[model samples]
Target: MGDVRVIEVKQSVFAENDRRADALRAELKAHGTFLLNLMSSPGSGKTTTLAATFKALRGRLNMAVMEADIDSDVDARAMDELGVRAIQLHTGGMCHLDADMTAQGLRGLEALATPDAPIDLAILENVGNLVCPAEFDTGASANAMILSVPEGDDKALKYPLMFEVCDVVLINKIDVLPYFDFNLERCRERILMRNPHAKIFPICAKTGEGIEPWADWLVASVRAWQA
Candidate 1:
């Protein structure tokens, strides 16, 4: 055995992360909380859409949010003003927030929930990366990925995994559709090919067009899961 030197590679990059995420899911399930992990490219209006969504769901259901980013808690601060329990997770230098990070974030949010009324909906605004974030589960009951018109419809083909795992595909910034070259038909065709079961919702987060249907679908989805 010439010099017999070997380095033990016992750790998985995502192993610990997945374990923590599974636990988080169990905890939320026990409380009957439905988790929605929102994914999208930076500036795709995911955070803004979340704010609008929370506004629409506030009185109707017990809601909370865990917003994750590489830096700055601005998104969390923005949601807090809307009167729902919300917290921010700074991923430090991590490009994508995994299960462990989300678990801690959810803990902070749990404290924000009312004592008598447990959380019904907990939306995780995943770190704004259209790629790596889609690989991890984050213990979300469903993954909702937003694709804006500015990003173009060809995105579904380029990032099939993201579209494949998504529970819903939201076409944001539709009001500006006329100004851009986004092809709606091509977008839907690609998404359906990746995930036929994924429900599609088109909306302009800035103008609030087609948001009600998305919100309604969300509310109904939560109720269905809870029931």
Candidate 2:
């Protein structure tokens, strides 16, 4: 042993993030706001699915949206066009949003909200990197991910963390399943291995085939969050 002292690092960098996430959750709950953090790979049909979801749930609840990306305000503008309050957050170059970033985004969204039009549900469309987004908690009341048929059934295996952390999983573009070699049963099995209780739904967002049930489940979830 030389004349030097050694220090041990016992806490993880994620520890602080997780702690802040818990606090954000409590704050959101106090306001009766249910924040849903949505994640997926690029081109997962999140926008189309979200559009259908808004159509189904509109006028049933007070809703808002926060679209996060490295650049561009396109999605936020699109959501605003749907008659819902929307905000776009630019990460500058970061790939994921930690609890603090999410809180800041929510604050911006809140400023646009009004007492006559309070938000009961807020959906945060996170940056489109399954791996990075899944590694951080955003204090959402629920977490969900969309997996398109083109992405293949193997995604659940390759991106286990995404499936593991999500409370809900939507298999979008089911109408195109016949054109692909995707195995629905196998994919379900793989996801169940990571999260046995995940509520999985198959939907054709463009065709509006499965939007009603999804919207119903989501509405129930938002109300339950308040309770």
Candidate 3:
């Protein structure tokens, strides 16, 4: 007879992470907080957009931001100065934040939110890296990608999965469109082809151009999600 087989089960690579994400989602729903996972490459205006967006929506929404970076707290500091409850998550050299990291951030924000108003909005500015971050679920109500004109319009074709998974796409740095060869129509066409349900908004974060509509759509979206 063959020797008795022995099998040792091991920890799930995504066990704690998925659990935390589920809990975080439940907590946010209870607090009426809408979470948006903003993802993009470095210099894609993710931070700039958040700074401007939170500033615009503060009076109307109880907003907070969770900034994720590999090392620096600079983005978090900037968002804090804007009067939004902001916190920095250092991934300690990790390329991306899993559900576990976002759960901790949610707890911190929960502590700050008032019980009455609670946190109606939680913007999670994901790590600068695009590919890895896109792979992890951070317990956000929606996934958004900011693609700057400088990054070129062909991005959707190259990183198909990111565009495929995102619910919204922000075409940032549009004010500089005159300099770049980015064709807005082509970008929209390609991205929409990949994600038929995606809502695309073009805006220049520095000049605050086209922000109102974007923020409006965002607010309406969150409200609809609550409903």
lDDT per residue for candidate 1 within 72-177, as digits (tens), equals 4345556767767777787887777788778888888888877787888888888788889988879888899899999999998899899998999999999888
In model 2, state the lDDT of residue 94. Answer: 91
Best prediction by lDDT: 2
Q: Candidate 2: deviation at residue 2, Å?
A: 15
- RMSD to native for every prediction? 2.5, 2.1, 2.9
- TM-score of predicted structure 2: 0.94
Name the better of 1 and 3 by TM-score: 1
Tell me how candidate 2 scores on lDDT. Answer: 0.89
- What tens-digit string does per-residue lDDT give for candidate 2 at 1-227? 77898899899999999999999999999999999999998898988888899988878988888888856334666777776787877776899988998999999988999888878999999999989999999999999999999999989889989999999999999999999999999989988998999999999999998889889988899889888
Better of 1 and 2 by lDDT: 2
Q: Judged by TM-score, which candidate is best?
A: 2
- Clash count list over all predictions: 0, 0, 0
What lDDT would candidate 3 get against the real structure?
A: 0.84
